[model samples]
Target: MSSTTQKHRNFVAEPMGEKPVTDLAGIADVLGKRLVSHGFDRAYIVLGQFLVLKKDKELFVGWLQDLIHCNVMQASNCWQCLNDWCSEFL
Candidate 1:
């Protein structure tokens, strides 16, 4: 499968703990830096945003684009990662 798929699986398979935002699928170093600069340094922090958005894909995807100017594919990957993680853990 694709690298993003692997990333999604790996992210969803474990407790997020203090994993850096970069560990999340589609959050590359540059995007992760942007997110960290905006106070979303950890995966769990991003997850919090996902939860705050009520896990609505549109809102979360729009928020990511608005916040960091990420493309739809990246934001979608991140949303899917969080969704799967929630399904497995919460």
Candidate 2:
């Protein structure tokens, strides 16, 4: 997995704008393409799903794992990243 401290810092520090799904901390090349293929092409699109699920932590993490095969740590990192982004940005 890629280091997220920097990635997380960068992601939350600015408006998401048009950043792609891969810009998300846990989503590397393979997972980013998978997400795009699944119609989640952008970071905001995934965030939309997170909002659609009402920001439910377990549900979001479970969805990431079940749908994209994110491991436990990946899901956890993603969940925390998004949550913090929401706190700062939303």
- Candidate 1 lDDT over 37-76, as tens digits, reads 9999999999999999999999999999999999999999
Which pairs of residues clash in candidate 1, taking residues 3 or more apart in a chain or in different chains? none
**Weakest lDDT window of 10 consecutive positions for candidate 1:** 1-10
lDDT of 2: 0.85
- TM-score of each model, in listed order: 0.94, 0.91
- Looking at candidate 2, what is the lDDT of residue 48? 93
Report the C-alpha displacement of residue 67, candidate 1, in angstroms.
Answer: 0.5
Off by over 4 Å in 1: 1-4
Runs with alpha carbons beyond 4 Å of true place in candidate 2: 1-4
In TM-score terms, candidate 2 sits at 0.91
